[model samples]
Target: MTRVRSLTAALSAALLLLSAAACGSDGDDTPKSVAPKTAALGTLTPGVIKVAVQPYSPYTSVQGDKIVGLDGDILHHVAKKLGLKVEPQVTDFAGMLAGVQSRRVDITIGGVAWSADRQKQGLFTDPPYYSPPAMAVRSGKTYKTVDDLKGLDLGTVEGYVWVKSIQAVPGAKLHAYPDANGVFDDLGAGRVDVGFLDPLIIIAAQKERPDLKISTQYLTPPTAAEVKAKPAYQYFQPYQTGFYLPKQATKLERAISTEIDAMYANGELTELVEKYGGDPEQFLRPDDAAAAARRGVDRPSDWTPPAIAK
Candidate 1:
């Protein structure tokens, strides 16, 4: 009987050990520790992100090989938020679009305007950065409002919605130019009595040529579709810029959208515009530069950046 009891006790001990082993998994069945793998944000990662940038003045430009401008600065901020290094590739305004489509760069930061057409090509983020006002002004007469250009020969870049808007008004002859600069130059030469142009360029031109007259009144509030319709028109207005990602770039798109929202919440975006050329009080949601700067941070010192309204 004693021998039988001892055998039973031993059997119970073995069963307990087996149960423990089965429950514990002996490090074999244990869940393997997932090594902290870095996220694959395409060919780009947390350390370095290649960007396509345009040397368009006020929005983006190259300063001694360093990409600099309101839009470039905003991309730099986005890069910083993502804990990534930035490498900016300078290209022509039209070429920047090609770089992004080819995946030669992870992103483009040259104040690209969002539009329904571009949406067909790839994904875009929410809330356009800036929409600079467009103005209809007479050649030599400084008018204060759209009413001033009511009977004048108002010109707009061909194929732009702004031109359509001008055409809607009776007696408003819409002369289409290949580019805004040409329209403005024509106005300067008196070939056209008036031209519609981005307000900032108008401001810059007005500063340089006081003899040129602009109606103080803006003809229309800028929209992203107008800016995105063509790269050529974008080169003229260049505001209402938004982030562009490859089609179905879900991870990268989500990261950028999150960072942009955080920036808006933190008010860092608002500060950038104040630093650039926009009114802080009026340009909060519709115009923020922080996202533009952070997305393209090429240098350690450029981690903080802003502005696409120029």
Candidate 2:
């Protein structure tokens, strides 16, 4: 009986050991150690993330020689999370887009608006923020509605969607310029009666030229009846600003998108936006289903990356 009891005790001990091993612990009820969470580094060049930034203040700007602003801060956060260093390349908006297309830079984050034309050229990560298009006119000009600007000259950046909106107005003269400075210059000089542009741009322009006044209302898409009546007019859409990535860099784009989604959830993106003079609530996209639906479609078939200049 004594021998049998001793054998039974040994068997119980063995079962306990097996149970502990299966549970990944020493029978002491201690929790198992978990591996630390690490960010997925996808298709990024080793050690460095080259960023092309347009000198758009509040979004991105050059202070002395260093890049700074909302997009700059966000880029730094993303690079840190990915364990990469940032190499900023400041240029005009067109140049920044070209740099991303040509692979001269890994990505760009200078408040680029998400447009169908841009989607055809490359990939834009889910929009991190949004801003509506606004109009800037001389202080003395009293315009209450988009239609009021008819018969007056309107200025806007060449590639911006504002061009289409201005074109839609009957009798309105549209003057497209290469950059914001040129457009604002014409507006200030009375060459153009109105400057339809980004709200942030309008804000900056107001600071520079106190004589300039921003409209109280933003331009919106026209009603169905208006669209039918004025088929030529393309109404202004809100800017869903996002990071631009190369066409071949799908993995990188996904990685960045994931980070952006997390940032929005955790309020980090809002913090950055507020830090750079933007309305956090207005810009943040916590639920962007439409953007997700359009994520990976519409790449340009005939597009080729530009050759990097030596």
Candidate 3:
């Protein structure tokens, strides 16, 4: 009887050990359960998604603690779509890229064009929205095109692609400034013969400075390959500026891209852009899906819009 009891005890112990092992093994060690609660699909954690921005007049700006403008409006919509909440971390144009590169801000949209150099370090919006370059000069001169400034002294913003074109001219002396306002000031004071600024800012300046004149003609840089054939004038390509995730956030990247495409197809995206004072036609077509396909752009998938919490 004692021997029989010992055998039964050993069997029980073995069963316990097997049960314990089964409990501990989590199959593939993947998450067996989702978070008990989630804010929304696209919304970042509350107060997350730091945005870097500057006053790109008519598009985005900082007033008091709130960010305003077309891009701001679109971002607000993006937050709502993502089911995440965010507040703008306003900074100067010069600091925008640094903010994103350092992870201080999750994204930036201060009219930054998608250049080859930036692409080396950043991921831009799947499709560019708008790009209209302008020429700013003192009251008296006229620049029908960049070729007209062959022998002139021009002021342009440094670190901007526009400067690359302005600097390439054979006899064009370029003075680089830190900001758009500075560029205009230098040109107005005759410190530089001419300047290149964004069209919206140019319009804002005209409202404020009756003496500042801009040509109706848009001057942007041609592609590097076209430099030899095109005049050394500013010729901007369609720059689709949008939120950029860090290189590691592959999940977030795919999610945002998919949802954005959905928004575009539904016309919600274009409507929101227009509400913020942008020309939807510049970025989307009546049939957004077709438009995106034609442009070889990505579509939105899963995300939620941002909310304005009072």
Worst 10 residues of 3 by lDDT: 301-310
Candidates 1 and 2 compared by lDDT, better number: 2
Window of ten residues with lowest summed lDDT in model 2: 301-310
TM-score for each model:
0.62, 0.68, 0.62
Which portions of model 1 miss their true places by more than 4 Å? 1-40, 43-46, 136-150, 158-161, 186-194, 211-217, 220-240, 280-310
C-alpha lDDT (0 to 100) for residue 211 of candidate 3 = 60
Question: What C-alpha lDDT values do all the predictions have?
Answer: 0.55, 0.62, 0.54
Better of 1 and 2 by TM-score: 2
Model 1 residue 193 CA deviation in Å:
4.9
Query: lDDT per residue, candidate 1, 149-244, as tens digits?
Result: 567787777655566556654576878887667776777777777666544455556556656554433433324464455323332332445677
C-alpha RMSD of candidate 1: 22.0
TM-score order of candidates, best first?
2, 1, 3
lDDT of 3 by residue, 196-288 (tens): 766556656766776655432345434545545654432433344556554444555555656666676667766665564345654442222
The candidate that achieves the highest lDDT relative to the unseen native structure: 2
lDDT of 2 by residue, 135-227 (tens): 777776677565787799988777566677778888999998877889877776779888877666666667666764434235544555665
